[model samples]
Target: MPLVHIDLIEGRNDSQIKGLVEDVTNAIVKNTGAPAEHVHIVLNEMKKDRYSVSGKLKSEEDQ
Candidate 1:
């Protein structure tokens, strides 16, 4: 089985997230010849406060 893990800030709607997982799974299947059913995808959505850049928290921005 092939496992793909993705982490992103929490904001995207359900459809966008679903598309991401599907796209990744399709790419893995096409390139690695892995079965769709055997592919494992994990999507981790973190709160803005849990992420940061340049020593500043993401939630501090005008998101």
Candidate 2:
């Protein structure tokens, strides 16, 4: 079994996350010889205010 964790800023739509999970699972199956059903992917979405970079919080205004 393979456990994969991915953290990203919140806001992705369901379809995007679904596709990402599928792709990641497939990659693990191909590279680590793990069965698709044995691969696990956990996604953690963080709020913009909860994340900081260069001493600044990530926000829409930062763009």
Highest TM-score model number: 1
57: Cα error in model 2, Å: 0.5
**Model 2: per-residue lDDT, tens digit, 1-63?**
799999999999999999999999988988989889999888899999999888888984568
Model 1 — which ten-residue stretch has the worst lDDT? 54-63
Instruction: List per-prediction Cα lDDT, in the order shown.
Output: 0.93, 0.90
Candidate 2 TM-score versus the reference: 0.91
List candidate 2 segments past 4 Å from native: 60-63
lDDT score for candidate 1 against the true structure:
0.93
Candidate 1 steric clashes = 0
Cα error, candidate 2, residue 44 (Å): 0.7
